[model samples]
Target: MKEKIIETSIELFDRKGFKETSVQEIVEAMGVTKGAFYYYFKSKEELLRDICLTYIEDLLQQQERILRDENKDCTTKLYEIVYMLIHNIRTRRKSARIFFREMRHLHEEHLQEIKAKRRAFRENYQKLIEEGIAEGEFKQTHTPHMVTFGILGITNWSYYWFNPDGEISEEKLAEIYVDLILNGIKNREGK
Candidate 1:
Protein backbone atom coordinates (compact mmCIF):
# COMPACT_ATOMS: atom_id res chain seq x y z
CA MET A 1 0.00 0.00 0.00
CA LYS A 2 2.77 2.38 0.96
CA GLU A 3 4.65 1.51 -2.23
CA LYS A 4 1.57 2.13 -4.30
CA ILE A 5 1.06 5.51 -2.67
CA ILE A 6 4.63 6.50 -3.29
CA GLU A 7 4.58 5.28 -6.85
CA THR A 8 1.33 7.09 -7.50
CA SER A 9 2.70 10.23 -5.93
CA ILE A 10 5.75 10.01 -8.19
CA GLU A 11 3.54 9.87 -11.25
CA LEU A 12 1.33 12.72 -10.06
CA PHE A 13 4.25 14.86 -9.00
CA ASP A 14 6.00 14.28 -12.28
CA ARG A 15 2.99 15.05 -14.44
CA LYS A 16 1.51 17.86 -12.38
CA GLY A 17 4.60 19.37 -10.76
CA PHE A 18 5.15 19.06 -7.02
CA LYS A 19 3.30 22.23 -6.07
CA GLU A 20 0.37 21.41 -8.29
CA THR A 21 -0.08 17.90 -6.87
CA SER A 22 -2.17 17.52 -3.74
CA VAL A 23 -3.10 14.86 -1.20
CA GLN A 24 -6.65 14.67 -2.51
CA GLU A 25 -5.44 13.95 -6.01
CA ILE A 26 -3.10 11.25 -4.76
CA VAL A 27 -5.77 9.53 -2.65
CA GLU A 28 -8.35 9.74 -5.41
CA ALA A 29 -5.91 8.33 -7.95
CA MET A 30 -4.92 5.48 -5.64
CA GLY A 31 -8.51 4.75 -4.59
CA VAL A 32 -7.50 5.15 -0.97
CA THR A 33 -8.47 7.44 1.88
CA LYS A 34 -6.62 10.35 3.50
CA GLY A 35 -6.12 8.22 6.60
CA ALA A 36 -4.09 5.76 4.60
CA PHE A 37 -1.68 8.42 3.43
CA TYR A 38 -1.24 9.84 6.93
CA TYR A 39 -0.66 6.32 8.23
CA TYR A 40 2.50 6.09 6.15
CA PHE A 41 3.55 9.73 5.76
CA LYS A 42 3.08 12.57 8.20
CA SER A 43 2.58 15.00 5.34
CA LYS A 44 3.18 15.52 1.66
CA GLU A 45 6.54 17.16 2.35
CA GLU A 46 7.71 14.08 4.19
CA LEU A 47 6.71 11.88 1.28
CA LEU A 48 8.51 14.14 -1.17
CA ARG A 49 11.60 14.04 0.98
CA ASP A 50 11.47 10.25 1.07
CA ILE A 51 11.20 10.06 -2.69
CA CYS A 52 14.17 12.38 -3.17
CA LEU A 53 16.25 10.48 -0.67
CA THR A 54 15.46 7.13 -2.27
CA TYR A 55 16.34 8.40 -5.74
CA ILE A 56 19.61 9.99 -4.69
CA GLU A 57 20.61 6.99 -2.57
CA ASP A 58 20.12 4.63 -5.50
CA LEU A 59 22.22 6.91 -7.72
CA LEU A 60 24.99 7.02 -5.12
CA GLN A 61 25.10 3.25 -4.80
CA GLN A 62 25.23 2.82 -8.57
CA GLN A 63 28.05 5.35 -8.81
CA GLU A 64 30.00 3.59 -6.06
CA ARG A 65 29.78 0.36 -8.02
CA ILE A 66 30.90 2.10 -11.20
CA LEU A 67 33.94 3.52 -9.43
CA ARG A 68 34.75 0.16 -7.83
CA ASP A 69 34.54 -1.89 -11.02
CA GLU A 70 38.05 -3.24 -11.63
CA ASN A 71 37.25 -5.36 -14.67
CA LYS A 72 36.88 -2.43 -17.06
CA ASP A 73 39.33 0.23 -18.11
CA CYS A 74 38.78 3.82 -17.00
CA THR A 75 37.53 4.86 -20.45
CA THR A 76 35.05 2.01 -20.77
CA LYS A 77 33.80 2.50 -17.23
CA LEU A 78 33.32 6.22 -17.83
CA TYR A 79 31.24 5.60 -20.95
CA GLU A 80 29.23 2.92 -19.14
CA ILE A 81 28.47 5.30 -16.28
CA VAL A 82 27.04 7.90 -18.67
CA TYR A 83 25.12 5.20 -20.56
CA MET A 84 23.67 3.95 -17.30
CA LEU A 85 22.38 7.43 -16.52
CA ILE A 86 20.79 7.77 -19.97
CA HIS A 87 19.10 4.40 -19.59
CA ASN A 88 17.95 5.29 -16.09
CA ILE A 89 16.35 8.47 -17.39
CA ARG A 90 14.65 6.61 -20.22
CA THR A 91 13.04 4.01 -17.95
CA ARG A 92 12.53 6.18 -14.89
CA ARG A 93 11.60 9.40 -16.63
CA LYS A 94 9.06 10.53 -14.07
CA SER A 95 11.28 9.83 -11.12
CA ALA A 96 14.15 11.59 -12.83
CA ARG A 97 11.91 14.58 -13.52
CA ILE A 98 10.76 14.82 -9.91
CA PHE A 99 14.23 14.24 -8.52
CA PHE A 100 15.92 16.90 -10.62
CA ARG A 101 13.12 19.38 -11.17
CA GLU A 102 11.35 19.32 -7.80
CA MET A 103 14.24 19.23 -5.37
CA ARG A 104 13.78 22.88 -4.45
CA HIS A 105 10.47 22.06 -2.74
CA LEU A 106 12.17 20.09 0.04
CA HIS A 107 12.73 21.62 3.48
CA GLU A 108 16.18 22.82 4.54
CA GLU A 109 17.43 19.70 6.27
CA HIS A 110 15.94 17.41 3.67
CA LEU A 111 17.34 19.65 0.94
CA GLN A 112 20.79 19.41 2.53
CA GLU A 113 20.65 15.63 2.52
CA ILE A 114 19.73 15.49 -1.17
CA LYS A 115 22.35 18.09 -1.98
CA ALA A 116 25.01 15.99 -0.24
CA LYS A 117 24.07 12.99 -2.31
CA ARG A 118 24.18 15.11 -5.46
CA ARG A 119 27.65 16.27 -4.45
CA ALA A 120 28.80 12.71 -3.96
CA PHE A 121 27.71 11.82 -7.49
CA ARG A 122 29.58 14.81 -8.94
CA GLU A 123 32.66 14.11 -6.82
CA ASN A 124 32.75 10.51 -7.90
CA TYR A 125 32.79 11.56 -11.54
CA GLN A 126 35.41 14.18 -10.84
CA LYS A 127 37.56 11.50 -9.25
CA LEU A 128 37.19 9.35 -12.36
CA ILE A 129 38.25 12.26 -14.59
CA GLU A 130 41.26 12.89 -12.34
CA GLU A 131 42.21 9.25 -12.64
CA GLY A 132 41.98 9.46 -16.40
CA ILE A 133 44.19 12.52 -16.38
CA ALA A 134 46.77 10.74 -14.28
CA GLU A 135 46.70 7.81 -16.70
CA GLY A 136 47.22 10.18 -19.68
CA GLU A 137 43.87 9.16 -21.11
CA PHE A 138 42.47 12.68 -20.67
CA LYS A 139 44.11 16.01 -21.24
CA GLN A 140 45.50 17.98 -18.30
CA THR A 141 44.61 21.31 -19.91
CA HIS A 142 41.12 21.45 -18.36
CA THR A 143 40.10 21.21 -14.71
CA PRO A 144 38.67 17.80 -13.89
CA HIS A 145 35.90 19.17 -11.70
CA MET A 146 34.76 21.58 -14.41
CA VAL A 147 34.86 18.83 -16.98
CA THR A 148 32.94 16.55 -14.67
CA PHE A 149 30.25 19.15 -14.08
CA GLY A 150 30.05 19.89 -17.77
CA ILE A 151 29.55 16.26 -18.63
CA LEU A 152 27.01 15.89 -15.84
CA GLY A 153 25.10 19.00 -16.88
CA ILE A 154 24.75 17.78 -20.45
CA THR A 155 23.78 14.20 -19.59
CA ASN A 156 21.76 14.88 -16.47
CA TRP A 157 19.57 17.57 -18.00
CA SER A 158 18.61 15.26 -20.86
CA TYR A 159 15.57 14.28 -18.82
CA TYR A 160 13.97 17.52 -19.99
CA TRP A 161 14.28 16.68 -23.70
CA PHE A 162 15.44 13.12 -24.31
CA ASN A 163 12.98 10.75 -25.97
CA PRO A 164 13.17 7.02 -25.41
CA ASP A 165 11.55 6.46 -28.81
CA GLY A 166 14.12 8.69 -30.52
CA GLU A 167 16.50 7.40 -33.14
CA ILE A 168 19.62 7.64 -31.00
CA SER A 169 20.49 4.65 -28.83
CA GLU A 170 21.77 5.15 -25.28
CA GLU A 171 25.18 3.72 -26.20
CA LYS A 172 25.55 6.04 -29.18
CA LEU A 173 24.59 9.07 -27.07
CA ALA A 174 27.09 8.05 -24.43
CA GLU A 175 29.78 7.60 -27.08
CA ILE A 176 29.01 11.04 -28.50
CA TYR A 177 29.39 12.57 -25.07
CA VAL A 178 32.60 10.63 -24.46
CA ASP A 179 33.98 11.71 -27.80
CA LEU A 180 33.00 15.35 -27.33
CA ILE A 181 34.70 15.45 -23.95
CA LEU A 182 37.84 13.59 -24.99
CA ASN A 183 38.42 14.81 -28.54
CA GLY A 184 36.55 18.11 -28.36
CA ILE A 185 34.64 19.89 -31.14
CA LYS A 186 37.47 21.22 -33.25
CA ASN A 187 37.92 19.93 -36.78
CA ARG A 188 41.25 18.11 -37.25
CA GLU A 189 41.78 19.65 -40.67
CA GLY A 190 41.98 23.18 -39.31
CA LYS A 191 44.93 22.34 -37.04
Candidate 2:
Protein backbone atom coordinates (compact mmCIF):
# COMPACT_ATOMS: atom_id res chain seq x y z
CA MET A 1 0.00 0.00 0.00
CA LYS A 2 2.78 2.41 0.90
CA GLU A 3 4.68 1.56 -2.29
CA LYS A 4 1.53 1.99 -4.37
CA ILE A 5 0.95 5.43 -2.89
CA ILE A 6 4.52 6.43 -3.54
CA GLU A 7 4.40 5.12 -7.11
CA THR A 8 1.13 6.88 -7.84
CA SER A 9 2.42 10.07 -6.32
CA ILE A 10 5.54 9.91 -8.45
CA GLU A 11 3.51 9.48 -11.64
CA LEU A 12 1.20 12.36 -10.74
CA PHE A 13 3.99 14.55 -9.47
CA ASP A 14 5.99 13.93 -12.61
CA ARG A 15 3.09 14.88 -14.86
CA LYS A 16 1.67 17.74 -12.77
CA GLY A 17 4.61 19.00 -10.73
CA PHE A 18 4.78 18.66 -6.96
CA LYS A 19 3.20 22.01 -6.08
CA GLU A 20 0.32 21.35 -8.44
CA THR A 21 -0.34 17.83 -7.14
CA SER A 22 -2.78 17.74 -4.24
CA VAL A 23 -3.44 15.08 -1.64
CA GLN A 24 -6.96 14.75 -2.95
CA GLU A 25 -5.66 14.09 -6.44
CA ILE A 26 -3.20 11.51 -5.19
CA VAL A 27 -5.80 9.68 -3.12
CA GLU A 28 -8.28 9.81 -5.97
CA ALA A 29 -5.73 8.30 -8.30
CA MET A 30 -5.05 5.57 -5.78
CA GLY A 31 -8.77 4.95 -5.01
CA VAL A 32 -8.05 5.22 -1.32
CA THR A 33 -9.23 7.52 1.45
CA LYS A 34 -7.15 10.28 2.98
CA GLY A 35 -7.01 8.22 6.15
CA ALA A 36 -5.10 5.56 4.32
CA PHE A 37 -2.60 8.12 3.11
CA TYR A 38 -2.29 9.59 6.57
CA TYR A 39 -1.70 6.12 7.96
CA TYR A 40 1.41 5.65 5.82
CA PHE A 41 2.49 9.26 5.40
CA LYS A 42 2.02 12.02 7.95
CA SER A 43 1.45 14.71 5.33
CA LYS A 44 1.96 15.54 1.70
CA GLU A 45 5.27 17.14 2.53
CA GLU A 46 6.36 14.00 4.36
CA LEU A 47 5.47 11.97 1.30
CA LEU A 48 7.59 14.24 -0.85
CA ARG A 49 10.46 13.83 1.56
CA ASP A 50 10.09 10.09 1.38
CA ILE A 51 10.19 10.28 -2.38
CA CYS A 52 13.35 12.35 -2.26
CA LEU A 53 14.98 10.05 0.28
CA THR A 54 14.07 6.93 -1.66
CA TYR A 55 15.63 8.25 -4.86
CA ILE A 56 18.89 9.49 -3.35
CA GLU A 57 19.31 6.59 -0.93
CA ASP A 58 19.12 4.06 -3.74
CA LEU A 59 21.68 6.07 -5.72
CA LEU A 60 24.05 6.28 -2.77
CA GLN A 61 23.81 2.55 -2.18
CA GLN A 62 24.55 1.73 -5.83
CA GLN A 63 27.42 4.22 -5.76
CA GLU A 64 28.90 2.70 -2.64
CA ARG A 65 28.96 -0.70 -4.29
CA ILE A 66 30.74 0.66 -7.38
CA LEU A 67 33.21 2.58 -5.26
CA ARG A 68 34.01 -0.53 -3.24
CA ASP A 69 34.83 -2.75 -6.21
CA GLU A 70 38.63 -3.03 -6.26
CA ASN A 71 38.66 -4.72 -9.68
CA LYS A 72 37.65 -1.54 -11.48
CA ASP A 73 39.86 1.52 -11.55
CA CYS A 74 38.60 5.08 -11.29
CA THR A 75 37.94 5.37 -15.02
CA THR A 76 35.92 2.19 -15.16
CA LYS A 77 34.02 3.18 -12.05
CA LEU A 78 33.23 6.55 -13.64
CA TYR A 79 31.71 4.82 -16.67
CA GLU A 80 29.74 2.49 -14.44
CA ILE A 81 28.30 5.41 -12.51
CA VAL A 82 27.41 7.31 -15.67
CA TYR A 83 25.81 4.25 -17.25
CA MET A 84 24.00 3.54 -14.02
CA LEU A 85 22.38 6.96 -14.02
CA ILE A 86 21.53 6.98 -17.71
CA HIS A 87 20.16 3.45 -17.50
CA ASN A 88 17.89 4.54 -14.66
CA ILE A 89 15.86 6.54 -17.17
CA ARG A 90 14.10 3.35 -18.27
CA THR A 91 13.03 2.29 -14.77
CA ARG A 92 13.16 5.41 -12.62
CA ARG A 93 12.34 8.27 -14.96
CA LYS A 94 9.51 9.73 -12.94
CA SER A 95 11.31 9.41 -9.65
CA ALA A 96 14.45 10.83 -11.17
CA ARG A 97 12.50 13.73 -12.59
CA ILE A 98 10.93 14.40 -9.21
CA PHE A 99 14.20 14.16 -7.34
CA PHE A 100 15.82 16.59 -9.77
CA ARG A 101 12.96 18.91 -10.76
CA GLU A 102 10.43 18.76 -7.93
CA MET A 103 12.52 18.68 -4.77
CA ARG A 104 12.30 22.42 -4.02
CA HIS A 105 8.98 21.81 -2.27
CA LEU A 106 10.58 19.90 0.59
CA HIS A 107 10.75 21.70 3.94
CA GLU A 108 14.03 23.21 5.04
CA GLU A 109 14.94 20.31 7.33
CA HIS A 110 14.12 17.76 4.67
CA LEU A 111 15.93 19.84 2.08
CA GLN A 112 19.10 19.76 4.16
CA GLU A 113 19.08 15.98 4.42
CA ILE A 114 18.57 15.54 0.69
CA LYS A 115 21.24 18.11 0.00
CA ALA A 116 23.75 16.23 2.17
CA LYS A 117 23.10 12.98 0.31
CA ARG A 118 23.43 14.79 -3.00
CA ARG A 119 26.70 16.27 -1.81
CA ALA A 120 27.98 12.82 -0.96
CA PHE A 121 27.19 11.67 -4.50
CA ARG A 122 29.09 14.60 -5.96
CA GLU A 123 31.99 14.16 -3.54
CA ASN A 124 32.31 10.51 -4.40
CA TYR A 125 32.60 11.32 -8.10
CA GLN A 126 35.13 13.99 -7.30
CA LYS A 127 37.15 11.45 -5.36
CA LEU A 128 37.05 9.11 -8.36
CA ILE A 129 38.45 11.82 -10.61
CA GLU A 130 41.14 12.55 -8.05
CA GLU A 131 42.03 8.89 -7.97
CA GLY A 132 42.25 8.75 -11.76
CA ILE A 133 44.64 11.68 -11.73
CA ALA A 134 46.81 10.17 -9.03
CA GLU A 135 47.06 6.94 -10.97
CA GLY A 136 48.24 8.80 -14.10
CA GLU A 137 45.22 7.49 -16.04
CA PHE A 138 43.92 11.05 -16.25
CA LYS A 139 45.81 14.19 -17.11
CA GLN A 140 46.89 16.86 -14.63
CA THR A 141 45.71 19.62 -16.96
CA HIS A 142 42.31 20.00 -15.32
CA THR A 143 41.21 20.24 -11.72
CA PRO A 144 39.14 17.28 -10.57
CA HIS A 145 36.79 19.57 -8.67
CA MET A 146 35.70 21.37 -11.82
CA VAL A 147 36.05 18.21 -13.87
CA THR A 148 33.70 16.44 -11.52
CA PHE A 149 31.11 19.14 -12.00
CA GLY A 150 31.62 19.05 -15.76
CA ILE A 151 31.09 15.30 -15.87
CA LEU A 152 28.15 15.55 -13.48
CA GLY A 153 26.58 18.26 -15.57
CA ILE A 154 26.67 15.98 -18.57
CA THR A 155 25.17 12.96 -16.81
CA ASN A 156 22.61 14.90 -14.78
CA TRP A 157 21.18 16.91 -17.65
CA SER A 158 20.87 13.76 -19.74
CA TYR A 159 17.62 13.04 -17.92
CA TYR A 160 16.04 15.86 -19.88
CA TRP A 161 16.21 14.23 -23.34
CA PHE A 162 18.53 11.25 -23.55
CA ASN A 163 16.64 8.28 -24.99
CA PRO A 164 18.08 4.94 -24.07
CA ASP A 165 16.13 3.35 -26.91
CA GLY A 166 17.18 5.92 -29.45
CA GLU A 167 19.84 5.32 -32.06
CA ILE A 168 22.42 5.83 -29.37
CA SER A 169 22.16 3.08 -26.79
CA GLU A 170 22.66 4.00 -23.14
CA GLU A 171 25.93 2.07 -23.15
CA LYS A 172 27.08 3.90 -26.25
CA LEU A 173 25.93 7.20 -24.81
CA ALA A 174 27.91 6.60 -21.67
CA GLU A 175 30.94 5.60 -23.68
CA ILE A 176 30.69 8.68 -25.89
CA TYR A 177 30.06 11.00 -22.96
CA VAL A 178 32.88 9.58 -20.89
CA ASP A 179 35.11 9.53 -23.89
CA LEU A 180 34.34 13.15 -24.71
CA ILE A 181 35.25 14.12 -21.17
CA LEU A 182 38.37 11.95 -21.06
CA ASN A 183 39.43 12.78 -24.59
CA GLY A 184 38.31 16.11 -25.91
CA ILE A 185 36.55 16.27 -29.29
CA LYS A 186 39.47 18.16 -30.77
CA ASN A 187 41.19 16.70 -33.83
CA ARG A 188 44.79 16.25 -32.79
CA GLU A 189 47.70 16.00 -35.27
CA GLY A 190 45.98 18.25 -37.73
CA LYS A 191 46.98 17.62 -41.32
Candidate 3:
Protein backbone atom coordinates (compact mmCIF):
# COMPACT_ATOMS: atom_id res chain seq x y z
CA MET A 1 0.00 0.00 0.00
CA LYS A 2 2.78 2.43 0.82
CA GLU A 3 4.64 1.54 -2.34
CA LYS A 4 1.52 1.97 -4.42
CA ILE A 5 0.99 5.45 -3.05
CA ILE A 6 4.57 6.37 -3.85
CA GLU A 7 4.33 5.02 -7.37
CA THR A 8 0.97 6.60 -8.00
CA SER A 9 2.11 9.85 -6.46
CA ILE A 10 5.17 9.85 -8.69
CA GLU A 11 2.95 9.57 -11.75
CA LEU A 12 0.69 12.40 -10.63
CA PHE A 13 3.64 14.49 -9.52
CA ASP A 14 5.38 13.88 -12.78
CA ARG A 15 2.38 14.94 -14.83
CA LYS A 16 1.28 17.71 -12.50
CA GLY A 17 4.04 19.58 -10.75
CA PHE A 18 4.42 18.98 -7.04
CA LYS A 19 2.75 22.23 -6.10
CA GLU A 20 -0.10 21.37 -8.39
CA THR A 21 -0.53 17.84 -7.10
CA SER A 22 -2.83 17.54 -4.13
CA VAL A 23 -3.11 14.86 -1.48
CA GLN A 24 -6.71 14.42 -2.57
CA GLU A 25 -5.58 13.71 -6.08
CA ILE A 26 -3.07 11.15 -4.86
CA VAL A 27 -5.63 9.21 -2.82
CA GLU A 28 -8.23 9.50 -5.54
CA ALA A 29 -5.85 8.10 -8.10
CA MET A 30 -5.27 5.03 -5.98
CA GLY A 31 -8.95 4.57 -5.06
CA VAL A 32 -8.04 4.88 -1.41
CA THR A 33 -9.02 7.28 1.34
CA LYS A 34 -6.88 10.11 2.67
CA GLY A 35 -6.43 8.07 5.84
CA ALA A 36 -4.39 5.58 3.87
CA PHE A 37 -2.06 8.26 2.65
CA TYR A 38 -1.75 9.77 6.11
CA TYR A 39 -0.91 6.35 7.42
CA TYR A 40 2.15 6.09 5.21
CA PHE A 41 3.21 9.74 4.72
CA LYS A 42 2.56 12.73 6.91
CA SER A 43 2.10 15.10 4.03
CA LYS A 44 2.49 15.45 0.30
CA GLU A 45 5.93 16.92 0.83
CA GLU A 46 6.94 13.86 2.81
CA LEU A 47 5.96 11.67 -0.08
CA LEU A 48 8.05 13.82 -2.39
CA ARG A 49 10.95 13.47 -0.03
CA ASP A 50 10.57 9.72 -0.07
CA ILE A 51 10.62 9.69 -3.84
CA CYS A 52 13.78 11.78 -3.81
CA LEU A 53 15.41 9.55 -1.21
CA THR A 54 14.50 6.39 -3.06
CA TYR A 55 15.92 7.72 -6.30
CA ILE A 56 19.18 9.01 -4.83
CA GLU A 57 19.66 6.04 -2.55
CA ASP A 58 19.37 3.67 -5.48
CA LEU A 59 21.86 5.76 -7.46
CA LEU A 60 24.29 5.88 -4.55
CA GLN A 61 24.23 2.10 -4.21
CA GLN A 62 24.90 1.68 -7.92
CA GLN A 63 27.69 4.24 -7.72
CA GLU A 64 29.34 2.49 -4.79
CA ARG A 65 29.49 -0.72 -6.81
CA ILE A 66 31.16 1.03 -9.72
CA LEU A 67 33.48 3.11 -7.57
CA ARG A 68 34.67 0.11 -5.54
CA ASP A 69 35.31 -2.17 -8.48
CA GLU A 70 39.02 -3.11 -8.60
CA ASN A 71 39.15 -4.11 -12.23
CA LYS A 72 37.76 -0.93 -13.78
CA ASP A 73 39.92 2.10 -14.46
CA CYS A 74 38.86 5.67 -13.86
CA THR A 75 37.85 6.12 -17.49
CA THR A 76 35.67 3.03 -17.50
CA LYS A 77 34.14 3.94 -14.17
CA LEU A 78 33.41 7.42 -15.42
CA TYR A 79 31.61 6.10 -18.47
CA GLU A 80 29.71 3.59 -16.36
CA ILE A 81 28.60 6.32 -13.95
CA VAL A 82 27.36 8.49 -16.78
CA TYR A 83 25.72 5.49 -18.38
CA MET A 84 24.08 4.57 -15.10
CA LEU A 85 22.56 8.02 -14.81
CA ILE A 86 21.25 7.98 -18.36
CA HIS A 87 19.89 4.48 -18.01
CA ASN A 88 18.13 5.53 -14.82
CA ILE A 89 16.44 8.37 -16.62
CA ARG A 90 14.95 5.82 -18.96
CA THR A 91 13.95 3.54 -16.13
CA ARG A 92 12.85 6.20 -13.68
CA ARG A 93 11.82 9.15 -15.80
CA LYS A 94 9.10 10.26 -13.41
CA SER A 95 11.33 9.91 -10.38
CA ALA A 96 14.08 11.67 -12.28
CA ARG A 97 11.87 14.62 -13.16
CA ILE A 98 10.55 14.90 -9.64
CA PHE A 99 14.02 14.50 -8.16
CA PHE A 100 15.42 17.26 -10.34
CA ARG A 101 12.48 19.53 -11.11
CA GLU A 102 10.38 19.30 -7.98
CA MET A 103 13.08 19.11 -5.32
CA ARG A 104 12.70 22.82 -4.65
CA HIS A 105 9.34 22.07 -3.11
CA LEU A 106 10.81 19.85 -0.42
CA HIS A 107 10.89 21.22 3.12
CA GLU A 108 14.09 22.56 4.71
CA GLU A 109 15.09 19.50 6.74
CA HIS A 110 14.28 17.13 3.93
CA LEU A 111 16.07 19.35 1.46
CA GLN A 112 19.17 19.37 3.62
CA GLU A 113 19.22 15.59 3.80
CA ILE A 114 18.81 15.41 0.04
CA LYS A 115 21.60 17.90 -0.47
CA ALA A 116 23.97 15.87 1.69
CA LYS A 117 23.38 12.79 -0.42
CA ARG A 118 23.85 14.86 -3.55
CA ARG A 119 27.18 16.05 -2.21
CA ALA A 120 28.23 12.48 -1.61
CA PHE A 121 27.49 11.64 -5.23
CA ARG A 122 29.34 14.73 -6.43
CA GLU A 123 32.34 13.93 -4.28
CA ASN A 124 32.58 10.46 -5.78
CA TYR A 125 32.39 11.96 -9.24
CA GLN A 126 35.12 14.42 -8.39
CA LYS A 127 37.19 11.61 -6.95
CA LEU A 128 37.03 9.82 -10.31
CA ILE A 129 38.17 12.90 -12.23
CA GLU A 130 40.94 13.51 -9.75
CA GLU A 131 42.08 9.92 -10.08
CA GLY A 132 42.05 10.15 -13.86
CA ILE A 133 44.15 13.30 -13.72
CA ALA A 134 46.59 11.83 -11.19
CA GLU A 135 47.02 8.70 -13.29
CA GLY A 136 47.74 10.78 -16.42
CA GLU A 137 44.60 9.38 -18.08
CA PHE A 138 42.83 12.74 -18.09
CA LYS A 139 44.32 16.15 -18.79
CA GLN A 140 45.29 18.52 -15.98
CA THR A 141 43.72 21.47 -17.73
CA HIS A 142 40.65 21.68 -15.48
CA THR A 143 39.89 21.43 -11.80
CA PRO A 144 38.25 18.22 -10.69
CA HIS A 145 35.55 20.18 -8.92
CA MET A 146 34.54 22.12 -11.99
CA VAL A 147 35.07 19.09 -14.20
CA THR A 148 32.70 17.05 -12.04
CA PHE A 149 30.08 19.76 -12.25
CA GLY A 150 30.67 20.07 -15.98
CA ILE A 151 30.17 16.38 -16.53
CA LEU A 152 27.10 16.47 -14.31
CA GLY A 153 25.77 19.51 -16.09
CA ILE A 154 26.03 17.76 -19.42
CA THR A 155 24.58 14.44 -18.24
CA ASN A 156 21.94 15.86 -15.92
CA TRP A 157 20.56 18.11 -18.62
CA SER A 158 19.92 15.04 -20.75
CA TYR A 159 16.80 14.21 -18.75
CA TYR A 160 15.08 17.05 -20.55
CA TRP A 161 15.61 15.55 -24.01
CA PHE A 162 17.41 12.22 -23.97
CA ASN A 163 15.57 9.31 -25.62
CA PRO A 164 16.73 5.88 -24.59
CA ASP A 165 15.14 4.33 -27.69
CA GLY A 166 16.37 6.96 -30.05
CA GLU A 167 18.98 6.40 -32.75
CA ILE A 168 21.73 6.93 -30.22
CA SER A 169 21.78 4.25 -27.56
CA GLU A 170 22.56 5.23 -23.98
CA GLU A 171 25.89 3.43 -24.30
CA LYS A 172 26.79 5.52 -27.35
CA LEU A 173 25.74 8.71 -25.61
CA ALA A 174 27.98 7.84 -22.67
CA GLU A 175 30.86 7.18 -25.01
CA ILE A 176 30.24 10.42 -26.87
CA TYR A 177 30.08 12.41 -23.64
CA VAL A 178 33.24 10.80 -22.23
CA ASP A 179 35.01 11.44 -25.52
CA LEU A 180 33.95 15.06 -25.46
CA ILE A 181 35.25 15.34 -21.93
CA LEU A 182 38.53 13.56 -22.69
CA ASN A 183 39.03 15.12 -26.11
CA GLY A 184 37.70 18.51 -26.98
CA ILE A 185 35.63 19.17 -30.09
CA LYS A 186 38.16 21.58 -31.64
CA ASN A 187 40.05 20.12 -34.57
CA ARG A 188 43.85 19.95 -34.21
CA GLU A 189 44.35 21.28 -37.76
CA GLY A 190 42.40 24.42 -36.93
CA LYS A 191 45.12 25.45 -34.55
The root-mean-square deviation over C-alpha atoms between each candidate and the true structure, in angstroms, is 1.1, 0.9, 1.0
Q: Over the stretch 102-160, how does candidate 2's per-residue lDDT look in tens digits?
A: 88988899999999999999999999989999999999989999999999899988888
lDDT of 3 by residue, 30-66 (tens): 9999999999998999999999999999999999999
User: What is the C-alpha local distance difference test score of each model?
Assistant: 0.89, 0.92, 0.93
Clashes of 1: 0
lDDT of candidate 1 over 1-191, digit per residue (tens)? 99999999999999899999999999999998999999999999999999988987888888788889888777987898888888887667888889988999998999998999999989999999999999888888999989998999988898888886799887788889889878888999986
Q: List the residue pairs that clash in candidate 1.
A: none
Each model's TM-score, in the order given?
0.96, 0.97, 0.97
Candidates 1 and 2, the one with greater TM-score: 2
Better of 1 and 3 by lDDT: 3
After superposition, the stretches of candidate 2 with alpha carbons farther than 4 Å from their true spots are none
- Would you give me the overall lDDT of model 3? 0.93
Residue-level error in angstroms, candidate 1, position 152: 0.9
Off by over 4 Å in 1: none
